[model samples]
Target: MKLTYGITDKLFVWFFIIVLIFFGTILVFYIDLQHIVKISANIVNKNNEISAASKKMIENLLSMEENEKKYRLLGKDDYLNYFDTARKDFEGQLKKIVQMEARGMAISDNWKNLYESYLNISPRLRDLKKAQPSKIPWIPVNVINEWIEKIYIARAENEYEVYLATTELNRRGQTSARNGLIGIGVSSMVGLLGIIFLAYTTLRPLRELLKGIRSISQDRFSEPIRIRSKDEFGELAGAFNEMSVRLKEEEQMRSDFVSMLSHEIRTPLTSIGESVNMIAEEVMGPVNDRQRKFLEIASSEIGRIGNLLNHLMQVSRLASSAIKIRPLSIGTSAFVSECIHGMAPAAEAKRIKIEAEIPPGIPNMMADPEHLKQVFINLLGNAVKFSPTKSKVKVLIEEDEAGTDLMFSISDKGPGIQEEEQSLIFNKYYQARRIRGHMDGVGLGLYISKHIVEAHGGTLWVESKIGQGSTFGFSLPTAGK
Candidate 1:
């Protein structure tokens, strides 16, 4: 089967493994504690049983001797029954003591053998008790005292062995419990360390992925992430880096396509425009009014197509950063007037007037002469196109006293740009929604104009409001001839 693990799945798998290890550690400690407790309980119970049996044997021996004295003094058979009963209880106690396994109790078996010898001498003593002190050769008092002393000694020895075994059992229990606690502590520490290491390894690549994702969100696709692990994160990083590369390539291809279309298509359109211009000028023959009107429409359509193609070419160049500005000194008065003259035909058709407020002694502007002409053409053309018939389009020029820069402005009296539209007007392909009438061409003119002004170390801006006149302008720094 093929293995498929994503980031979430991989992290979960690792976490489960760690948890299982912790549980396994706990289980080991639990099993050890159970064994220790059972053994300790057994040790305590056995010691108690052994001590009880020994104690019973000692008590019965004392009772039997006292009852035998009563029988010998009173010559009573009823007292002799008490001695017989004591003897039977002693035998039972000894049997119990012998059956127990004395694991740690040394001398327990020897003590039991010595206790059995007391039974053999018991029957002879019973016979002697009936015959009186003078009839028996040996004295009952000495023999009884000797046997009782031996029984006491054996009982004490058994009690001492039980005491030693119980003490050792307690010590072993404490030792086992202590070792279990230490094992638990060590295992927990190791588990915690392992979890920390695992988290670091897992989150490291995720952090890198976040960084790369943020970069893409901000439109940055230059660098690819490099991770050299064989885990799931490594695979994900490789995929993400591949996407970044593809995005970069696609952006390049887009620019190249635009650049190619603009260059490849401009040539034939230029030839067609030239041919139409010649025929319309009557170079071939004179034309009727109806034919003339058709020629005018064709000419205008050709001019519009040519303008669109020009804007597209400029856009491709600016997008790829291939445009280089060649700045030179130029007279603001002469340059501005020539740019205004080119738009005169359009202004004349709408009965719109151009007024220049040029002050003499204005410093020559440092700019790309061709680019500046285009900038003026865009600004002046927009002002005239938006102005109503018989309205004013004013061109203003000003200079700074430091001989550093000159400012050129065009103001039009028309349905002025709204507050929101002023900033967006310079963006590529943006047209104001509150436009007065039909507008020609794509929105590249103002955008192209803005770039050209900035390339010459100047700034372009607009000032306008709805229902008020609009003024669009730029500042140009002074430069050497």
Candidate 2:
């Protein structure tokens, strides 16, 4: 059976893993520390005690030798008593060392034997002096001194063993600390990787959902979000996809309705326009000046309705991909100059200066002249329409940085578009809130123009800020491409 992991499940698993790693690291550190502590205790309590006992034995042995020599030289019984006391202290310390060895100390048997031989030799020397009191010259003083040196060597060896044990204990402690740090570092790294993984898993779906939302907002409902996880985000994605499909169906129905309605209205609108023109021209009957003026207004309004129908038809065609591009090599400079001249009258009515900054030697582009002209006229018309009286509308033509496309920009000094509304402007039937009632358009010009430019492998974009101005720019591929 396949297991489905949700976002919460993944988070729980990662958290658990991190916790396990943390505790496991701590456990390892605890075990290692316990071992180090054990070694440390052994060195401090046992090894160090053995070393101290060896030192005391050496001190007592030296004192015994001094007292025995003094007893023979001064013939003093007090020196003999001092020698016996030192011997007893030395034996007591040796016994303590032996007991420690039996408990678990690691003193060598060879050292113990040497200590025993030294003790036996001391009693033997006392016996020899007692047996031959007048024969002091025959005393084994050199042998006693030799045994003293041997015991001193044994004590040094014991101290060296203690030093080795202490060094080993220190090594173990350092190793434990180093291993603990390594374990902690590994655990932390694992935790960090888990966090990164979890974030990626979570944010990937969110990003996809955001992209789908943006697509839907732009009226692009064809592409569905693809999130495969068994999480809440995945369920959301499924719902989002369903909504997109429904929205796409609804948009298609609306487009078809608009197209059919525009077609149904166009024939009567044309006939009405002709009739109004005929009445204004006194073809049916002679009319008064007021009647003629009203007829003229009717004619103008009829013409506007006709234009709106035409725009709606065009938008429908664009939606259905029915419009075809007839590409031709068009001269850039002359074409732009003509569009500028056509818009000059509109600019003059607004008292706006239309400035053209076309440099020489600009490359020609391959595009359908009629379609491209429509886009130019729409952009320039918007610039002239929205521009403040006496303000400047600048038309700029140039090549992009890559020199692969021709760039046209229409900048107007008008109440500019808001930043929030910029992206929505290219969407069909979407108008800026501020200009909804003030503007004359049904908001299809830029939408139609954007589609036209994009159809020719170009892009249309706007840069604007309130109270500053707006610049609508587009790029078309040059003839070389």
Candidate 3:
């Protein structure tokens, strides 16, 4: 069994993937930031505590030195007591510094040895001072000064360590920021690619469906839409294909019926036309003026029916691709003149002037003479039929700009076709809305003429605007000189 993945399913999957990538990047960054913060905080806090303890030790050593100086000058027991007290306070601060060094502070070995020697000498120095009342040794005082200098050095080193820790923290912060920007950029690129993929998948099938609909509208029922997906559009395409097949079958049935009907009616109409023509010509007996007039009307009506039947037969033959053309080379000027002369009677009834612009030295075209004449007659007849009285109908023939084809155009001063309907005018049985009730044709003239032109490797087109008159034109390849 094949899995049917719809557009909704695809959208959900892509959304989930994008969300996962975004959050995964954020989580990794959070872990890295926490690690950096922990390490930096430990280093900075330890260095700050060591710095504070070293400052207190320096003050205690200075007091010890001051009290010893008083004992040597005045020789008092109270001064000795003050010296002992300051010594003990200094010992307490030294112990604290040792403890911090064991944890992580980087105190120098020289500083530690100096601290131990000062502790060992301080008690003996006090006793000797009591024993000898007037004399005091200068050696223990010098040792105390050296210890004070060591404390200052340790404090400066601790402050420097603090600065180094702060700098490391800032560097880590910048690195995290850069990594975050890279992560965001990657996520956005992935999201944009996902959006483009989704749009292409969705719109491709819709475009194919639209194209198929347009083809069907133009009477093409054989082209099927091919969408290779297990989605709603696929189902719709299957149904559309079925509908096209049914429409093609129905169209064939209709064409066959029209062809059969036209054939059955044409034989009787031909016989009746002959009988009416004979009566109008008075071949059977002499007739009065009134009788002759009625006979003439009957003859004309019969002839019109015959022409209508002939048109129906021609349309059927064209549809079946059974109309074969015999190509011949004809003089361009003379042939166009003959068509114009044939249409002159109809134009005269409306007092419309028919003008021709056949430039000298126009080349002859390769086309079926009979079928080509029919095309010209159909075009000219439409012009004469639609033009108002005293209006001018113009015919122009010339070589196209490429110098390889002949272009013929018929222009009429009639109510023109609308722009929207111009493309649809050549379709079978498609009558212009404005001329539907007023026009006499069943809209087959242009349709048949278009096919006839196309059979000879040519194209027919119209240019028109509402109330501005219409020009119908066609191009035919010329016979090479």
- Best candidate, TM-score: 2
Which pairs of residues collide in candidate 3? none
Clashing pairs in 1: none
Cα lDDT of model 2 by residue, 1-481, tens digit: 9988888888888888878877887787788778767777777876677667767766777787787678778877687677767777777777776676777767766457756776665565454435544553322557556656766676677678667767877877787788778878887898889889888888999999999899877856649888888789889999999999898899899999999999899888888888888777789889998898888788878888888988999999998989899899899989999998999898899899988998899999999999999999999999998888989999999998898999889999888888888999998888889888877999899999999999999999999999999999999999988
C-alpha lDDT of all candidate models, in order:
0.76, 0.82, 0.82
Candidate 2 lDDT score at position 137: 31
All candidates: TM-score: 0.56, 0.82, 0.80
Ranking by lDDT: 2, 3, 1
Question: Local error of candidate 2 at 341, Å?
Answer: 4.2
Off by over 4 Å in 1: 1-38, 41-45, 101-110, 123-187, 220-222, 267-481
Error of 2 at 164 (Å): 4.1
Worst 10 residues of 2 by lDDT: 131-140
List clashing residue pairs in candidate 2.
Answer: none
Tell me how candidate 2 scores on lDDT: 0.82
What's the TM for model 3?
0.80
Give the residue spans of candidate 3 off by over 4 A.
Answer: 48-175, 282-295
